[model samples]
Target: MGKSERNITNWKQYNQALVNRGSVTFWLDEAAVNAWHCTKHHGGRGRGFQFSDTAIETALMLKGIFKLSLRATEGFINSLFQLMKIPLIAPDYSCISKRAKRRCCLNKRNLFRFP
Candidate 1:
């Protein structure tokens, strides 16, 4: 095939997929909400925390989805918990930052990769 004649065979499908990318979605199920509670950090100097790894991880996921700062993520999560009537505590920005550093590095490609 000539250079000008060579093009993506599925260009229309690709365009549709690109347009659908804007409809981002995030969900926290009932089971997850029930499991979202503070757990004791073994061997840590301080007392047990009020937000478990699940909560932190969830907030991190939303942070990427919503393109929010750490503090904003915390607030957003807190609001969501309140709105859902889930009596769970939200992690502060500093707590999120510290825990996030210990948990994993930021890899936008891995988190935001489509399909």
Candidate 2:
């Protein structure tokens, strides 16, 4: 076993696996993001004052752009947003609740549009 790709038969220590992956930098370009922005979900409430493009954009970015965990995803989104010049980083587990593999946040869905 001189070959670098060979898998160790026993767990001695320093086990490594080589993964061939496409770089994120290639995909995070403006063209890709702009396309995603146009297709992202637009939840309906018959708007008088609805959620900003930023909130939805952040949500989409977490779920699609960065492909982060819902907890981490929501955390990232919350961190970037501001309410009346205040940082809106709410680390609420219930913010991305999962009862049966389906996320549900009844309160936050209607929580002043993440303003």
Candidate 3:
């Protein structure tokens, strides 16, 4: 036998499936969002951190997963927030870099957990 033949009978359904395949879904847990900003103050001379460690970790995780540069990672996170209609801001690239450098050792924790 040669190559098999296929028929397209449902054009609308086929088109919809194609579009759905390219669609992506993202959501932020309310608890995670609440923890995005650091609430505990370290009582330092200079200004304290605005974003929490979880936020920075999440940003760095995204950067690594997407293979994006620092600036691009910031932009990507900001865009995701905007798309989700969340009144939150992503950590700037500089902040990410600073925090990333400050980490002495990487902990054995799952960084990709959402819930």
RMSD of each: 6.2, 11.6, 5.7
Q: Write the per-residue lDDT of candidate 2 for residues 4-113, one digit (tens) a residue.
A: 78767755343322222443322234443344223433465653322334334445445545656667766665554442234334334443333212322223344222
Tens digits of lDDT, candidate 3, 10-114: 999999999998776668788888899999885878888999988998888878767789899999999999998888999999999998877422334653443
- Which candidate has the top score in lDDT? 3
The worst-scoring run of ten residues by lDDT in candidate 2 lies at: 97-106
All candidates: TM-score: 0.65, 0.28, 0.68
**Whole-model lDDT values for every prediction:** 0.77, 0.41, 0.83
Q: Better model by TM-score, 1 or 2?
A: 1
Tens digits of per-residue lDDT for model 1 on 9-111? 8988989999998874445798778767765664668777667777778878888878999989988888887877778767889988887777755676686
Backbone collision tally, model 3: 0
Judged by whole-model lDDT over C-alpha atoms, candidate 3 comes out at: 0.83
Model 3 worst lDDT run, 10 consecutive residues: 104-113
